[model samples]
Structure formats: structure tokens, C-alpha cells
Target: MYNNASVNKVFLMGYVAREPRIHNSKNGKPQLSFSLTTTESIKTQGGDIQHSEVHAIKINADAACLKDVNLKKGDMLYVQGRLQTHAFVDEQLIKRYKTEIVAIGVELFDPIQL
Candidate 1:
């Protein structure tokens, strides 16, 4: 009988679309941002169709952690994180919202393994 309403967790396993961008937050904390691409094959009445989706990921960590990971383009990564929505005003003074995955843990596998 324990039901928690606040549940926001996400797990994604895919290829890195590009090199991760490293930047510092307003509080001087190191942050990383990247795009992950996931693909799936769907079978319809006609035939199988391949579909792909890209996700924006953000990670808040220290410089040492960033240096250790060294994520690169085309690398396979497994990310465990939570969904976060950010609202901000664009240059045109229009309100915009973006949802991204705030990674709590990330794992990198060598290309040779698979």
C-alpha cells in the first residue's frame, strides 16, 4: 500500500550522436550535455520499419568525473537518470520548454565488445 506519486526515472541505451559539450553552470559547477540516438524496428502490416529518436541529456558532476568519462561521438552509452523540464524565454521573448534527462549514472562500453 505504498504508492509514491513522485516518480521520475529514465533509462536509455544508445549511441552518442555527437561529442558532449562541457560547460560550467552559473554556480561554477561542471556540467555536460549531449545527444543520444536510439533506434527501434517496428513491424506493421506491410513490413518492418526502422525508427530513431534523439534525446538531450545533461549531467552535473565535477571536472574529474568528466575527464574520466571522456565521452565521444559514436560511442555506446547506457544512461540512468531522471526526467527534468526546463522553461525559459527565448530570444524572441517567447516562452519555451525543453525536457532533458539529468543523468545520475552513465556507463560506457567499448565498441569492440559488441
Candidate 2:
């Protein structure tokens, strides 16, 4: 039995940390992956400090999103999607996991200057 009682959603507004890489999945579907960086300034006991966090984003647009917009490094964007985690084993027999936002929609803010 399943009930629609929960949701998995994420929203991020940050700058692109690197150029988007487009690839094809095993099923031959197009996929896009990129890194995004978000920064924030927090007031601490000592003073205000700035902190930056980087996130790995995976867009399943399958080339449709890139048809019109040109995305590049350092460009500001707003990403909306759901959070997904992938787990794997390392060479040393250690378990590792990574969480990424599976972008369903992306909006470009500041376009990169040529």
C-alpha cells in the first residue's frame, strides 16, 4: 500500500562551478551534469564569516533544456528538482555515497559574457 504523504524536493540558487557535461545514459537517453556553488555570510561570535558550498547537479533534460539556453561556468542559475543519493563501494572496500539534485527545471540568471 502506498500513500502520497511525502515529498522530495529541492531548490537551489547558485553559480555554476564548472561547465556542464552532456552525456548519454546506458539506455541512450541524454543527461547533463554540472557543479554549482552557493555562498552565504554568517555572523559568528568573532565576526561575520563567509562560507561556500558546492553541489553536484544532474539534469535529466535529455538535451531539451540546452536547446535554447547556453550554460557556462560562473553563470548564476536557479535549479529546481528532487534530491537523489547514489551509493557505491570504493576500491578499498569502503562504502561511499553521493547526493545530488536531479534537476527538473533550470533557470539561467546571469549569462556568461563571451
Candidate 3:
């Protein structure tokens, strides 16, 4: 028996829901976080249905990547990264879990016309 499989990648293309929240990490690394919304329509027994999914993205990149690009709400983007899950305890001492896309690359598209 032979096993050879290794892949951890995610690709998403969607519109930015809001402006990115920029901040610095403890080690002084630049970080950008934003919400992306992807929508799709599916055929079901009832009828055609529209569905939308929002993904939280966090980008840890160099200063150039975060400073040179002007990111804004409603901007279309293509992101490639890996999925990451974080577990922490809230103020109430309850455990919480969150899944987010840790973006390695981001490409900004032209503004979407309505």
C-alpha cells in the first residue's frame, strides 16, 4: 500500500463586504482582515433558490502588500489561501471556535457595476 496525498489550499472570488481592518501583530507584522461575500443560486425541489455565504479572511503579508494596495468596500477580489480554525475562550469563560481563511495572495478586481 502506498499513500501520497498532500493538499491544503482554498480559492475564493467574491466582493468585499466592508473595508479591511488593518492592524499590527504582536511581532509588528502587518495584518488585514475583511469579510467577503459569495453568492450562488441553486435548483431545489421547491424552486430556484439564492444563497449567499460570507467568509472571514485574514491576511498576513509584508508592508508592501498591505500598504500599496487600496482596499475598500464593494471591491471584488480573488483570494488564495488555506483554511484555519481558532479556538479560544471568551470573557464568559466559554469556549468558542472560528474558521477563517488565512490568505496568502490577494488580487483586486475592478469595481463591480450594478
Candidate 4:
């Protein structure tokens, strides 16, 4: 029996780390790939320090979507999507895993000063 009680959603708001890459899917649809850097501040005896993490994002849509939104590097971006993990075997027959967000919606906002 299945209860269907599992959720794997993710929401990320951060600065684009680099230019997004566009690729063609097997069916010829466009796929956009990019990474965003999110920061967290930790309070310590030496005062607050910032730590950042980069997340890989993938958007499956038309290339025109990029132009319509004018998405580019250094822009503040908000993404709504789900987390996915990919598994593969390396040349050495070792198994590797990667995790990424498959974006369902994306939006741009003015840069927020940290």
C-alpha cells in the first residue's frame, strides 16, 4: 500500500553565480541550466560571518523565456521547484550521485543588499 505522503519541493532565492547554459532536450525543447549562490550568516564570538552555498538549477522551457525575462548572471533570482538526484557510473565503475533543482517557475528581483 502507498500513502503518497512524500514531498520534495524546494524554493531558492539568491544571486545567479554565472551565465546560464541552454541545451536541447531529446524532444528538441530547450533546457536552461544555471547555478545560484545563497548566503547564510552565523553569529560567532568573532561577530557575524557569512557562508554561501551554490545550487544547480535546471529549467525546461523555450529559449525565448530567457529573452523575455532577460535573465543573466549576477541577477537576483527566485526559483520554485523540486529536488532531484541523478545517479551514474564513472569510468572506474564507481557510482556517483548529483542533486539539482528542476525549476517549475522562475522570477527575477532587484538585488538585495546583504
How many steric overlaps are in each model, in order?
0, 0, 0, 0
State in Å the error of residue 1, model 1. Answer: 3.9
Worst 10 residues of 2 by lDDT: 58-67
State the lDDT of candidate 3 residue by residue for 1-114, as single tens digits. Answer: 448877889999899998899788668887889999998999999999999999999998564445578888898989898998989999999999999999988888775542
| lDDT of every predicted structure (CA atoms) | 0.88, 0.86, 0.86, 0.86
Tens-digit lDDT track of model 4 for 1-114: 669778889999999999988888668888989999999999999999999999999888663345578778999988889998999999999999989998888888886553
TM-score versus the correct structure, for each prediction: 0.86, 0.86, 0.84, 0.83
Give the clashing residue pairs of candidate 4, or none. Answer: none
Residues 1-114 of candidate 2 have per-residue lDDT tens digits of: 557688999889999999998888668777889999999999999999999999999886554655688888988999888999989999999999999988888988854532
Better of 1 and 4 by lDDT: 1
Give lDDT: candidate 2, residue 74: 88
Ten contiguous residues with the weakest lDDT in model 3: 60-69
Worst 10 residues of 4 by lDDT: 61-70
Backbone clash pairs for candidate 3 read: none
